[model samples]
Target: MLPYKNPELPVEDRVTDLLDRMTLPEKAALICHSRMTAGPIGDLPGDLFPSSEELISERGITHFAMMAVPDPVTMATWNNHVQDLAAATRLGIPVTLSSDPRHGWASNPATAHSGGGFSAGPEPIGLAATDDPDLVREFAAMASAELRAVGIRVAFHPMADLATEPRWARISGTFGEDADRAVRMIEAYIAGMQGGTGIGPDSVACMVKHFPGNGPQAGGEDPHFAYGRDAVYPGGMFEHHLRPFDAALAAGSAQVMTCYSIARGIGVREVGASFNRELLTGLLRGRFGFDGVVCTDFNVVTGMEIPGVVSLPPRDWGVEDLDDVAKTALVLNAGADQLGGESDPGLVLAAVSSGAVPAERIDEAVRRILRDKFRLGLFENPYVDVDAAAKLVGASRGRELGRRVQARSLVGLKSAAAPVAPARIYVENIDPVIAAGYGEIVSAPEDADLALVRLKAPYDKREGLLESAFHAGSLEFPAEEIDRLRTIAERVPLAVEVYLDRPAVLTPIAEFATVLAGGFGADDDLALDVLTGRAVPPGVLPFDLPRSQRAVEESRADVPFDTADPLYRCGHRCPRA
Candidate 1:
């Protein structure tokens, strides 16, 4: 290893000098870290988030990405930690803190800063439903302010994946099932988050994700967990998926993330795009000509080791069949700028020392990281106010837009006026305060004479996102919980609204309820409109809902739900007359 000497040099020189000094262990350490992993110096949880102090340290770690934390103040604390770390680090390198996209109040750890009270504003489906480009831009810009105010610089969001399947759990999180809509929203999303020029001292950078089309996963399963492998684009039909990434680059997406799922038979290891050359260099850099920071989707390397103990299907990609050293080699060769999750940087250093990877490659990655910090003005000034970080959260203009988007994205599946006799309504899982804004907010389903029964929740069961993440699949409802819903539906003409995340069967409610609606996210306004017969359902089934595990398996890969003899054909929206 070379000696470290260029202390006063520019970012580029310092990066080169720093790389020259680091041993393999230290370099590998830079690439891997657990989200919110509490190390000796910082205090955090084990959900793959990072502390601010860890970011600014001169310990040769520049890329700091955090996932799965769901709070704003906690997020603020995390950012403040980064700022302090930057100030205290020997090199004073302000950490480039990045998130998956917490635009809405969902505060999904993937996108938003982790912790309490962070708003999970609305799902991306809401933006596409509005079909208003200008509005989309406004929303993005608003969201940018919100993100920046909280001390985060980059957003790992605007998932450009075309939601072509109804069964895909990540669909509600995307723009929609259309490529064009996704592309347009990508532009708007990037513009909103990255465009505001220190306007009122707020503006978050954007990171367009799941590059080169992650929508084609054989089944609707997300690549994040196991079982969700094979993103087959059959004969380069993948052009549609690339559209959004192109548009995002043109619109100035500061950074781009790789997909964890496997792509067709090509990179069968389910290796993330972060380490895929076809995705990073061939497509993004070679074709699109994007010269920005390139980071991996979180914990991708470590994820390969996961055996996906969390995901349902026990599976293995072909890469695991190859030599372990070669596997990590492929990722580094693929052009990943920075490693993600709690990966060990040792893989990267070993690849370098053993001559599997060229020193130039590692240097290039470091350059990109430095370039981003430079652009962010971190080199000039890398600190943020702590008090301000807390104040700015949930105060951005994008929050309302999130609600509107959620309302607009809703698609009424089943609505019936059959034997109907009521002007008002009420429900659980919904705050009457939020409900009243859209329509009647009642406290009693029985008193209303007609019940618009909507399951306003993430899953049909009450398992939280964190719990479900670990559970993977095999998710089921307890008998006590099922009994309560059964009794209520049987007594009233229930308008059963269901949130279609994974394949949630509502045979119980269907037995007694009058209506069933999918895609019930946070806001109930849009669902409310559909129930009241104000908004006609235009949503098509993104994927087929398998009645049984056997059906889900037997279904075709491209179009999983065959219309010939499927439980629910694609585009099967039961509209009101």
Candidate 2:
């Protein structure tokens, strides 16, 4: 009944069966890219690994990252379907379903891999708050089980960057401020994610991220954009950043993701880490001895963000925005073994024909991709039970885990107005019944003795040309919101909670709103507890809120956050008595 083959054969044999007959185009498609892009799903109209599998069968792509994968059931169904498709091919090459770390409940975009609807688990800050490596690993192991259940063999997660300054909001996603803490927690996380027999065929492969550190984005901000461009360490604190990577490498992580955040005047991100030879082959593969697959961060390629006007539907074959071949060459030369986004294999095939990249290079990348597949034994026991999807994915255990992380990761920064928790609480946005438990929640800010306002603070650092060109012409809060806050402040002790991801310029809270509290990825009760003092507010300041734009512009890149000595410090905490 299986298309790929009977699950009994060794994965190597299965792969070899498929590998021998492929043409260059099929192979190029396999090794270069994977996606969750728009398209109908189902193994390439009955091809292995979804729509592309048939092409690979006709040609030679033994390795490819799986995409469009739904929840656990869909994941298993798709994976099994891929294996079946492989069996139908002469080679019956099995594919590995990889994921962004989908644990507790939050789907981290930071990954190309994930099982959707994951619990909103605790991030690095929460893990750090626990200060328990065992707990960290426990979360990892649980995540591993969830991933493994859905037939995901690889997990792209366990970010281990050291939180260097207050400006970096990404710190919430990492373990903590100290390098040692990050290293230790990462070790535990890997152990947990790897699951069971340590390093055996059944373990989930852990892909540690943003190698060589990406935490100290200049100005305590993310380098996702031009203004946040490149990581700089004039402090020479670069070595500290490398510690986690070293630990992960030493621990034998299955893969490493190159950071999109560029470092200094070094390397090229016009193509990103996939094209950074200094980063890929030189440092990770060579110096670190990382034999595993090295991949690029999402949509980092030159042509990925091309103008829509140039690209037409159904392969209309029109004039384009970027030269695909040149970008492909850069990726290959930079030692990238895979591609991200809507990269077509036609370009690689063209390159091969034109002698731009030797056929040997294609083979090199293809073989590596296949070899990893061989190593994972995907060829054998490829199809997972559609039922296993239900069993492991939405288990109550995962939800509990997420809830716990949400609790621990709650970082209580500043609270000026006295904490207030009336059993009957009123909120403008939350549901009433839901309010009854936290207190009788309300729909309007004006009615309650205590008003809880949820505000989303700034996160991404200055990037995009538009962003760089952005000038803060004035500091102003919304008049109505401010007026509302002032009114609420008058009626009752107001609790203004913000989903603070980055250090914000807290200009004049509208006098109406009183009692300010904020932290990254806040859970409702976590905010409530911090207000009621039911839970001690253990969150600390990861970045400082500057009072003015002039001070931000004058600051040096790579300098620690709070450089201007704003209103907060690293350890500033407001705990319940």
Candidate 3:
């Protein structure tokens, strides 16, 4: 047996043995984390990238980020097939599969996948609303087990970024704006996912992300687009944003993912976090002492274009003028171990050949990458039991816990005139069948005892295909929608529930609705349970609800709880009446 294949060998020894025998191409493949399609066993048509089989066999790629939310059985089978492909390679290096947050209701194809065949849980903000680190740990434990069942080893989440900017598109994914609370939640998350034994077979290594915080985007726009590339710190809260990452590193997080935004106003160069040596090597590695794998946010090396679906230029930010080879070299020299959402191994080879990138840097990155795979025990057994997957993934107990969490995470802002037991409920954006279980469903507000309305936090629609997925822009509801809501409230006593993906300007809704609440990610059933007297909403506001769009616009993006006279302060909750 090869020394690297020996189970009894030390992981470092195994990594060294493997590194010695690996060809330059194999090392290059290990450092590139690319996206892969998930569905049937065969490659689906209309795929813009190479197939999994082609990636592993031809390019020797081992790391993949799966975006699809297929059924557990199909996912397990596909994972097994991927393992089979990897096992046939010359070195038999097992594939490491990672995914964005998949146990939540939020389904942005660009960010998180839907909870298909997985236990449904509240978003990270909802977990923060609970303000229970133990419960956060419990959710993470459940998510970790489910992920491992379907052969996913890495979790691209527990986004430690503070939601300082209330209008940030990705606020729902964060643990809220409080640095101290975020620290507790992030530590618990890492402990739950990685487990007490650390990055072993039973663990799903947490890649605590958007390091140095991604929440302070200038004007609350995402860094995914050119217009939103700058992450400004006008409030001088740049160091404050690093608190959660400090806690994450202390908790033994296995990996870190950089943000796409170009950090400005700090001493570092105005470039994306992934290509900033002072941030990655100086701050994260040197000051914080985090030596784990640092993966860049997706598609930083090159732009992507899927015919008619999406067209995203490379999020190179300040370094867009650099060629692909130069970009690749800069990322490597910046101390990132992997290029996320990138598939071309030829670029790495080209960079090294042209002397733009040092061969020593490649070796160092390969060592870190190989070390993680070994620590994860993927080297010994990469394949999962197909039969166990169905039974283990999204089990009944897990789903029940999710439902309970969802109900508990609903934050009541106003409940003074909430209906205790209305006979007829007029519903909007709610399942009539689910409403029937609680009360008689009425079609019109005039005929009903009370109106139950569900709304999403306001966001102006963007035209770009990929850009639209991010819920950016204004927090105020449109004038027409507000007018319609006003009409309903006037007809009958109104109970309003808004999904707080981002903090909404709730002043208008609060003025009319007798009962108003905010939720992060809850199902119709769970929302109804809270609306009726069946469930008591114990959650508090994770972040402030701005009083108006003007206050939101006036507030500094880098500072938390900066909006003046917010409709509801952070941690505000209505007492049960």
Residue 30 alpha-carbon offset, candidate 3, angstroms: 0.6
Candidate 3 residue-wise lDDT, 471-557, digit = tens: 999999999999999999999988889999999998988898887888988889888766665666789788888899999899999
Best model per lDDT: 3
TM-score per prediction, in order, is 0.75, 0.77, 0.98
- Model 3 residue 107 CA deviation (Å) reads 1.0
Model 3 / residue 327 / CA error / Å:
0.5
What's model 3's lDDT at 213?
A: 79
Worst 10-residue lDDT window for candidate 1 reads 306-315
The whole-model lDDT of each prediction reads 0.57, 0.59, 0.89
Residue 82 Cα positional deviation in candidate 2, in Å, after optimal superposition: 2.3
Cα lDDT tens digits for candidate 2, 20-136 = 666776677776545432123443332222345544455434344444456666666666655666667654556666666555323323333334645456555556655567777
**Can you write out model 1's per-residue Cα lDDT over 157-186, one digit (the tens) per residue?**
878777554345566567765566667777
Go through the candidates in order and give the C-alpha RMSD of each one to the true structure. 6.2, 6.0, 1.2
The candidate with the higher TM-score, 2 or 3, is 3
Give the Cα-based TM-score of candidate 2 against the true structure.
0.77
